[model samples]
Target chain A: MTAATADRVVAEARVCVAAVLDPELPMITIEDLGILRDVQVHDGRVQVTITPTYAGCPAMDAIRADIEEAVHRALPDHGVDVLTVLAPAWSTDDLTDAGRTKLAEAGIAPPGVSRLAGAGTSTTSRAAVALELSIRCPQCGSPDTRELSRFGSTACKALWVCRACSEPFDSFKNH
Target chain B: MRSTCEAVATEAEYAVALADDALVASQRLVEWVARAPQIEEDVAIGNIALDLLGQARLLYQYAGSLTDPPRTEDDLAYFRDERAFRNVCLVERENGDFAVTMVRLLVLAAYQRELYDRLARSVDPTLAAIAAKAVKEVAYHRDHARQWVLRLGDGTPESHRRTQTALEAEWPWVSELFDGGWLAPALVERGVAVAPASLEEPVLAFLREVLDEATLAEPDPRPAVTAGREGRHTEALGHLLTELQHLARSHPGASW
Candidate 1:
């Protein structure tokens, strides 16, 4: 394939793969969740790299299947491979602005800036977590929220109750 | 001495030991789902179990890769008999009660968090990468365990009593965690693994602070029943493995 053709194919593959929605967080795409790392094309073969938001996120299997299907459909002639990597780690900071807005719209609070604002280091100990201080309720836009469970329905989220609205919702856990 | 555990000499064996720790702990933790005192707790414990299971799979996969011809994670997890397991005895101990479970989780998480934090910089790239990912996940686990430990230890009179008892019961297994002789000395020298012995001081310091805050006294040190590193285990591991491996063993080539 020509360099330009290869580039076009790669770009197209990324678009289709990026549009694939996460299994659990259906409101956001895998790209929005920062789990989709890179998509590379070589000799009409596509390799898509991903990282799990939570190590044992059951959604990983579903997301892998979805990525394969999406890439196959978008680039019919190419073979697609999905690989999960565990380097550099997935932090809540990887969530995009678009993802944050989508999460809020879907009534799930976006994670606080604990990882981002902690001098850009992810200490993550109990005292260093600072996860609770900034969780504004998605329903009422109130900062008065209380954590119900450190864990939620999905691996990456925590269950929280909004004191202002009394509506329980999931908040992304800042890794 | 190192004579008993000398067989666990290579990186593969080291990885297997690590995987066994996670696999066994996951099995124990998952028992609490639906049995925990509250729905939130069920979710919390189950989530913790899932993380441990994930870590186990990663370690197993890495260990398999180092073999002459790679084995699958399932191959190691299912095929291994009780004598092949390298997990510390603490994990295989029954999840006696809420307090016992919390105490076990607290001690294990404290050790894992510190271990992973240092292991993240390991000379072995694959292990290092896995450790870097795990360090974050384990920090939350440690915090979760700490929160419960403090609550139970300092709560009501009964809670304090049970929590204290649980801590004392679990303390004997604590010494086994710091025995690094199971691994080849070269592994630590090469920066591929940390000496488990070196972890004792930091781990104890953290535990002491938490125990003090919770108004729980450290029990007198009991004689160490250490041999899990040498694949020697209490009767509990056999029963646990039967439950863990039966389905996979029966279904030979099954997958969803």
Candidate 2:
């Protein structure tokens, strides 16, 4: 294949792979979740690098498989490789505005702004510095919601209940 | 002549030691999945266990890469015998009660929070990266345990009594956590690993804060079962490992 054709193939592969939805959070694509790191065509091999949002996220294998299937649809003859990395761990700050919108529309609140201040902000600091911070209820748009549990159905969410609407929902746990 | 294992602990050894601690605690916590008092509790406990398991996998993979011939994380986790395991004794203990489990979770997660935070800046890049990721995840675990301790300690007469009893039951193992002697001194000096002893003050202070808020008194500071770091463990570890390694051993690369 010519250089231009290879470039076109890589771009098309990126589009297909990026559209692959996360297994657990089916509302958003991997690219929207910011887990899709890079896609490149090197020496006739297509390489895709992605990172996990949480260390033990059980959805990673499913994601890898999805990406493979997606890429194969675009370039059946090309070798596709998926590599998972750990450095620069994922944060809620990585979520795109579109992802946030999708999460809210789906009744799961997106991560709040404060959750983005990674590492230096400990729970102790959060309790003291950011008291009264509330997660907007996606169901009724109520600012009055209480956390039911620090963890939810998966590794990346917290269970919360709305005081106003009495609707229980999951909020993306800001890590 | 001394065996290579008898000499100074390599970075891989240190990684495996921590990994074993995570893996064992994870295995034990999995027992509470369907048995937790509430459905939320079940997911909460399971999530914590999974986070630890993830940390263990990362550490073991890093450890394997550093070894001469290299071992996969599974090889290190399943192929090793009980005597060869290097985790501390605290994690392998059976789940006595809800309080006992929470107390153990609180103490271990606190130590992990401290260890991973410091290890995030280690001289070794791979270890540093893993630690950086882990420190964030473990902070949530510590918080979960803390919240539970607060509830159990202050909830009701029966809960208060049970929680205090659990704290005491788990206290002896806390001493073993700060004993840094088993780790190679060079690792500490080179910033690859922190002296476990250095974590004592911070961990204790955090525990004390939680206890004070919850109206729970501190347990006796006496030491017990302090040799798991050196590979001498209570009978509990063997039993724990048997269950953990059973599927891997029996299936021998079998996948669904």
Candidate 3:
């Protein structure tokens, strides 16, 4: 295949493979969860880089297997390289803008960690910043809430309850 | 004196040092999920344990990589006898109360940050790589523990009293961590490990600062109950292992 064609194939493969839904959150793909990072084809080898949303996230093994299966189905005859990169660390910022929007729509609050603010501010403003974000209960749109736990169905999310509607909800905690 | 081989031993020793702490502590922390004094701390400690488990997996896997027989991480963790494990005694101690548990975590996480930070720059590529990744998570662990220490230390009459008692209960065990032996001298010389003694001054200073912030008295260094470094642990370890290993031992190869 030509160089241009290979590049197109790599890009197309990422879009297709990333579209696979996460088993837990069927509405969101592993890519939308900000787990899938880079997909490329070089020297006829398909290379894909992924990052885990949390340490010990059990879904990682499944996600890696799923990615391999999906990529193979999309582009056969190409050697696949699945690289799990842990450096430069994965952040909620890496979540696609569209991914964040989808999270809000799905009643799981999108992670509100903003890198646009200075790093110093991020550290100093942790509690204040957390409180500032109106994590309206996905169930009732009420900001009257209390955190139940720093963890939820997964390590990346927190268990919270809305006092107004007496609804227990999950908030995607910013790491 | 133990031979240098026994000191640093094989790569498995280093792996055991890391894995025991994570595995034992993770086991301790999970007990708090429904039982914590407050729900926030329950979730926080549980999350902390999860992160530690992740680190244990990497460390044990690396240890497995170095062994001739090639044991899996699970084998080293689940099958090891008490004497074979090398985590500090402090981590294995039961989570007494919210205050005691938080204090234990604060002390351990502080030491872990320094160890992982230094290890990140080690000559061993695998250790250095794992340390580099783990340091970030442990940093959060330290911060979370520190924040709680401050809140409980300063919060109320009851909180302040409990926090002080917890500090005293766990303070003696802290000395064992820095009472260096076998692994320390060799790994320090090779730049593969930070000498445990080197951590004393900085770790104490950090601990003191947190204690002061929390309005708690710094516990005087009492006699050391040293054993874990040389694989001597307290009675608490057996109980911990019994609970942690039950499912794995009873139903080997079982997966939910």
Worst 10 residues of 3 chain A by lDDT: A117-126
RMSD of 1: 2.1
Candidate 2 residue A38 Cα shift, in angstroms, is: 0.8
Tens digit per residue, CA lDDT, model 1, A65-101: 9999999899899999999898878888889999989
Candidate 3 ranges beyond 4 A from true positions = A1-12, A24-26, A40-47, A75-81, A112-149, A159-171, B184-186, B253-256
True contacts kept of each: 0.54, 0.57, 0.26
**What is candidate 2's lDDT per residue for A1-175, written digit by digit as tens?**
7988988988888899889999999999999999999999887678999998878888999999998888787888888999988878787778999999999999999986644332454434324211226889998898999989888999988899999999999988776
Query: What digit string (tens of lDDT, one per residue) describes model 3 on residues B73-156?
Result: 888888888888888899999877788888998888878877776777788877887776676566667777888899999999
Query: TM-scores, in order shown?
Result: 0.96, 0.95, 0.83
TM-score of chain B of each: 0.97, 0.96, 0.94
Off by over 4 Å in 2: A1-3, A116-132, B1-5
Worst 10 residues of 1 chain A by lDDT: A116-125
Give the clashing residue pairs of candidate 3, or none: none
lDDT of each: 0.87, 0.86, 0.77
Tell me model 1's lDDT, rounded to 2 decimals.
Answer: 0.87
Judged by DockQ cut-offs, the docking class of candidate 1 is: medium
Candidate 3 yields a Cα-based lDDT of 0.77
Better of 1 and 2 by lDDT: 1
Give the higher-TM-score candidate: 1 or 3. Answer: 1
